[model samples]
Structure formats: C-alpha cells, structure tokens
Target: MTQRTPLHPVHLELGARMVDFGGWDMPLAYGSQIEEHHAVRRDAGMFDVSHMCVVDLHGAAVRDLLSRLLANDVGRLKVPGKALYSCMLREDGGVIDDLIAYFIEEGWFRLVVNAGTAVKDLEWIGRHAAQAGVKVAPRRDLAMIAVQGPNARARVVSQMPAVYQERVLALAPFFGVAGGELFVARTGYTGEDGFEVMLPAVQAPTFWLALKAAGVAPCGLGARDTLRLEAGMNLYGNDMDEGVGPLESGLGWTVVLDGERDFIGREALVEQKRRGGLRRLVGLVLEDRGVLRAHQRVLAGEAGEGEITSGGWSPTMERSIALARVPAGTGDRVQVDLRGRLVSARVVKPPFVRHGQVLVNV
Candidate 1:
C-alpha cells in the first residue's frame, strides 16, 4: 500500500490527480501542470510536501557532528535561523541524499530530507551519530508544505499566526523561525520567493486550507520537478546516486576539499580533481519541437554523447530544457535523440526562469 500524507485527503478534495511518488500517494497535478507552474511563476502556489521527512538532531556535539558528516560545512551557517543545503555522501563519495539543514540553536539542527530516501537517510544519520556521539531524532510527527512563487512569501505569511506573521515578515531569505509548533523557513525549490513550513501533522489540513484561502494555487509534483530543474537544482535519484560523484553531478561546490576534515569520499574526489575534473553536468535547451526527457541521448560533434538527467517543457519559459551529464568538453551545439529523431539543442547554464523571468537566451 502506498503511504498517505496527512493532507492526502485535502489533495483529493481539490481534484488533484494523485500518483505514486517514491512509494507515497501524492499529487501529480491539480488539472493542468502548466497552469500550476505558471501560477507559481506569476503569483503563488503551494505543495503538500508532508511526505518529505523533517528530522531534528540534538545533542551537545551535534554541531561538530554535522560539520564532520555533511559535504558542505555547517560552520558556514552564522545566523540562528539560517539554512544550509548539503549532501550526505557515502564513504566512497556517492551521494546518499541532498537535504537542507536549518540551524535553530546550538547543538540543534532541523534537516528536511526526500521522502523515498528518508529511511535510508535516517539510518545513515543514526549510524553517523552513534560514532560521532550525537543524537538523531526523526520528526515524523511534522508535516511540510512548500509555498512558492513571486508572491509566495506574502500569500503564505497571511496564514501565519500574528506573532509568526510579524517574525516571518522580517525574516530574510534562507532563514527560518519557529513559531510555537510551526517552523517556517524562507526557502523553497522553485526559483521564486517562498517558505517551506514544517508543523505538526494534525495541523496540515488547517494550514492547507488557510493557504488556499490566501489564493495560493495547489501545485503538485509535476510543477515542482520542472521548477527545480529550471532553477538548476538536482534531483537525487535521477541526477545523482551512490554510483555518481559530485563532480559529475553539478555539486562540485558542495565538496569541501580545502579543509583538513576527513569527510567521506574525499580521497576519490581529490584524485578526480587532480586527474582533471570528471565529466561535467550541463543544462540543455531544445530549439526543436521535441521534448527533452530523462535518459535521452545528447550528441555533440564527432559522436560525443551525453545523457539527460531531468527535462521538461517549462511552463514559465514555454520551452523544453534539461540538465544533462556530458563529456568533460561538450560544446554549445548539441542534438538530443528523442524517440529516434534528432532534436537541436543548446547547452546553457540553468535558472531557465527566475523571479518570473527567463534566464536562458533563445
């Protein structure tokens, strides 16, 4: 049986087309995915991301423990409510999961992880805690809702309690604040201003209702995928896995090599860097009518081939684009094999659309 989130019924009542995502019953779209995506680009939209796991870690040594475990140093977080995005890697340097860690207080951090990988992430975090002498507490009791778009912040804030309303009003981007049992983070996957709220599961329906009343469209996973891809974000299983390293996964910046810390997979990354960086990941824009999809083959001059990891016809840009892992030297002019037909494409940096504007050149 597929797992159901606390707000699953709400999604159904809203006429959302539900599907199985990572073993959980989730919405694919409310009706038209493109319309939902556009809502987020032009106004505000919300997603019931309660399926995502919110784990809270606490212990005297938690700070030091995270600093040692995460590929991105947690020490970089200075502000109390600041959030840091990082990847937890295996000993061999394979990405276990990419998650956001929110620093609330000393020795306490809130980590939100992907639903499918939550159990695995928890196990890995627990194992790390055992060795590092920290405590890992999974917040299964909490549900997450992501409100994204140009007006996303404003729409979501209207639903917050007065105390939280004022606090969130002044909260800067990438920061989070806890209002009673509600934890609001000014962060989201879409390339738009928004918040990802974590609260008790029982309160999910209430919050969802409030957000709907505030005119935030009920967006689903379809829109979320296209939005994140356009924003240059990586999807864990599709973009990278335990078999692929950061250099090939567009996450080279997350790897901290300058430090003396002995994080997992450091040796291999060092070797790969010294040997010349591993094949790089790039964003591709299809000039042709064909849609670019995952696993599609991309061909450059002289038989050079790449593979698309994530692709879609962006509702904001109104064009097909994708993130592809290509040869270390793949060039701008490329062709993607879509259903046996070659489609002309241009390799470009992502954020195909940001703040209601298209970033890619036609």
Candidate 2:
C-alpha cells in the first residue's frame, strides 16, 4: 500500500496531481509546476513535507553517539537550537544518508532525515545507539510544513501568537525553536529565507489552512525539486547513493577530519584522499536549445567521460541544468550525449540560482 501523509486529503481537495514518490503518495503539482517554482522564488509558497522523518536522540551519551555516527562534528553547535547538516556513512566510505541534526539541549538532539531512507536510517542509527548507550525515538506523530521564499517568514509570523511572533520571526538561519507543541526552524531546501514548522499531526490541517489564508501559495514536489536543484542541493538517490562518498559527491566540506575523534568511514576517506584519481561532482548548463535529463553521458574531452547524476530543466533559469560526476581534470567545456546527438555544455559551479537571482554565467 502506498503511504499517505496527514495532508493527503487536503492535497486532493486542492486539485493536486498525486504520484508515488518513494513509496509515499505525494503531490507532484497542484497546478502549473513552473508557476509554483516562480512563486517560491518571487513570493511565498508552502509544501507539505510531513513524510520526512523526525527522530529524537536522548541519553547521556547522545553527543558521543552522534560524534561517531555523522561526518560533521556536533561540537560546533554550542548554542541551543543550532543545527548541522551532515551525512552518515557506511564503513566503506559510502554515504548512508544526509540529514540535519539540531541540538536542543545537553542530552537531547533532533534529526530530520529523508523520507525514503527513514527506515534504513533508523535501523542504522538503532544499531549504533545501543552501543553508545543512547535511545533513538522516531517522532511519527509530528507533521512538517515548509513555508519558503522571501515573504515566507512574514506570512508564517502572521499566524503565530503575538507573544511568540518576535522570537519566531527573529530566529537565526539554521536554528530552531520549540514553542509548546510547535517547532519552527529557519531552514529550507530551497535557496530562500523560510521556516519549516513541525507540529502535532492533528493540528497540521488547521495550520495549513491558516497558511493559505496568509497568502502562501501551495507548492508541490515538482516545484520543490526544481527549487532545490537551482539551489545546488543534492537529493538522495538522485545526486548520490550508497555507492558514492562525500569527497566525490561535492560534500567534502561536511566532513570533519581535524581531530582524533574518528567516525565511521574515516579510514576509507583518508585512504581515498591519499590515493587520488577520484571523480568529482560538478554543475552543467546546456548552451543549446535542449532539455537535460539524468543518465546522459558527458564527453569531457581530454579529461575522459562523465555521467549526469541529476539533470532537468531549471524553471528558474529558463534553461537545462545538471549535476554530473566527471573526472577531476574535466575542463569548463564538455559535450553531452543527448539522444544520439552531442550538444555542447558549459561547466560551472553548482547553485544556478539563489534568493531569486541567477548565480552562474548561464
């Protein structure tokens, strides 16, 4: 059976085109995907992200458990409500999953992981939690709603109680605050200022309705994908999987290797760095009038060949963009094998657009 989020019926009532996404029935688009994408860039839009899993870690050894589990160091998050983005790795240096961890207090931390990988991530975390004397609790009773874009914060604040409005609206980026049953975070997948609110599942419908009343457009997965891609954010199972490591996935910055605190896959990553000859992730922009799709072969001239891990028409840029894994020596120009016809493309850094502005030389 396909799983349904708490807002499934709401989506249907709003005329959303639903589709199976990673075993969950999710809305692909409510109306025009391009319009929804633009709404998030130009105004405010809200997405039902209730399918994502939230887990809480508790116990005296919670910090130690996280230090061993994630690539990024939790020690950096000294302030309460501070969040860190990191990837959990396998013993062989392969990525298990990328998640956001929030430090709530001394012995408590919250983690929001991908919906598709929630089960496996929990299993992996459970196995390690036992050894570290920590307890992992999945919070399935919570529903997440992400209100994103420049006007997103103001719109969300309009619904909040006046007493909490100041603190909630003043939240620092990548930080979260828990007020009663609601947990609001200043984080979003789209490259925009926003808030991801987590509240009781029963209250989701009411809160969602209130958001709509606040003039926030209802966006779907189609717009969400385009927005994240434009932000240079990686989607699990698309940009990376268990077969890829952080160093090659353009996520080396998330790994901490300075201290003696060794995490899983540290040895393998160290070896990979020393051995060299690694493929690297890069951004690509099509120069011609053609749409880009995943699995397209890229001819990197003297630097050998590569493959697109994730590719699509960027609605914000009004062109085709992609994330490709190429040989480290690949140059700024390459040819993409699109349906037996080779087309020239320009190699650039990721993040084709951010904060409603074009960042690359497209």
Candidate 3:
C-alpha cells in the first residue's frame, strides 16, 4: 500500500499532479513545473517533505555510535541545534546514505534522512546502535515542510505561533531550534535561504493553509529536483550509491579522514586515496539549444570518457546543466552524447545559481 502524508487531502484539493516517489504518493507539480521552479527562486515556495524520516538517537552511547558510523565527525557538533551534513559509509567505503545530524542536547541527537532509503537506513542504524547500546526511534508523528526562497524566512516566521516567533526568527543558517513540539531548522536543499519546519503531523494541514494564505506557493518534486541540481546538491541513488565513495562524488568535503578517529569506510577511503586513479565529478553547461539528461555518455576528446550522473534543464539558469563524473584529466571542455549527436559543453565549478544569481558564467 502507498503511504499518504498528512497533507494528502490538501494536495488533492489543490489539484496537484501526484506521482510515486520511492513508494510514497507525492506531488510532482501543482500546475506548471517551470513556473513553480521560478516561484522558489524569485519568491517563496513550500514543499511537503513529510515522507523523509526523522530518527532520534538517545542514551549515553549516542555520540559514540555516530562517531563510528558516519564519515563526518559528530564531535564537531558541540553547540545544541548545530547541524552537520554527513555520509554514512559501509566498511568498504561505499556510501550508504547522506544525512543531516542535529545535536539537540546532551544524550539526544536528531537525524533526517532521504525518504527512499529511510527503511534501510533505520535498519543499518539500529544494527549499529544495538552494539553501541543506544536507542534509535523514528519520529513518525512529525511532518516536515520546507519553505524556500529569499522571502521564505520572513513569511514562515510571520505565520509561526507567537511562542516560537522570536526564537525562530533569530535562527542562524545551518542551525535548528526546538520549542514545544515544533522543530524549525534554518537549513534547506535549495541554494536559496529557507526554513524546514517539523511539527506534529496533525497540525500540518493548518500550517500549510496558513503558509498558503501568506502567499507561499506550493511547489512539488518537479521543481525541487531542478532547484537542487542548480544548487550543485547531490541526490542519492543518482549522483552516488553504495558502489561509490564521497571522494568521487564531489562530497569529499563531508568526509573527515583526519586524526585517530576511525569511522566506517575510513580505511577503505585511505586505500582508495593512495591508489590515485579516480573519476572526478564536474559541472557541465550546454549553451547551445539542447537538454542534458542523466546517463548520457560524455566524451573529452582524447582525454577520456565519462557519464552524466545527474542532468536537467535548469530553470534558474535557463539552460541545460549537469553533474558528470569524467576522467580525472578531463579539462574545461567536453562533449555530451545527446541522442545521436555529440553536443558541446563547458565544464565549470558547481552551484550554478545561488540567492537568485547565476554563479557560473553562462
């Protein structure tokens, strides 16, 4: 059976186009996907991300368990509500999943993971937590709503209850705050500034209606994909999987390999680093009239060949863009095999757009 979010009725009432996303019936679009994409870039937009699971870790061994499980060190998250992005790795250095860990309080931590991998992630976490003597509890009673754009913070804060009004408005980026039953985080996948609010599932409809009344447009997964791509963010199962490590996925920054901290995949990562031959992830832009789609072969003349991991038409840049894993020697120019023709593309650093400004040279 397909699972419906607390806001399913609300989505149906709004005439949203529904689709199956990792077994959950999710909204793909409200009307025009491109228009909805633009709404998030230029103004404010909201998404029902309740399908993403929130798992809480408790007990004295919580930090120790995380230290051994994740690629990034959790010891860095000292201050309460500080969020750290990390990749959980297998013993062989393959990425199991990417997640956000929030230090809520001593002996308590919060983790938000991708919806598709929630079940496996929980199983993996539980297996390790058992050894560490920690408790892993999934917070199924909560729903998450992400309001993103330049005006996102202001709109969401204004609609929040007075008790949380002051604290939420004062939150810093990459931080989260908890008041009563609500947890508001100043974090988002979209490059634009925003807040991801987690509240009791029953209150979701009321809050969604409040945000809609405040002029926040309801966006779906269609827009969310394009927005995150333009932001140079990685989508699990597309950009990476259990076969790939962070080193080759443009996510080496999230891996903490220093010091005596021995985390999962640390030894494998060290061995891979010493081996030296690895494909590199790069951003590609097609200036000519064409769309770049995933799995397309990329040719770098005599340099080498690679494949596009994630590709799409960026609504913000108004052009075709992609994240491709090509030869380490691949230069600033490459050709994407589109259909039967090899199309030219310029390689540039990612974050194609941020805060309504195009970062790469178009």
- Over 152-201, each residue of candidate 3 has an lDDT whose tens digit, in order, gives 99999999989888999889999999998899999999899999999999
lDDT of each: 0.88, 0.94, 0.94
Where is model 1 more than 4 Å wrong at Cα? none
Clashing pairs in 3: none
The residue pairs that clash in candidate 2, if any, are none
Error of 3 at 110 (Å): 0.4
The TM-scores of all predictions, comma-separated, are: 0.98, 0.99, 0.99
Each prediction's RMSD over C-alphas, in Å, is: 1.2, 0.8, 0.8
Candidate 1 vs candidate 3: which has greater TM-score? Answer: 3
Candidate 3 residue 210 Cα shift, in angstroms, is: 0.5
Give the number of the best model, judged by lDDT: 3
Report lDDT (Cα) of residue 124, candidate 2. Answer: 99
Clashes of each: 0, 0, 0
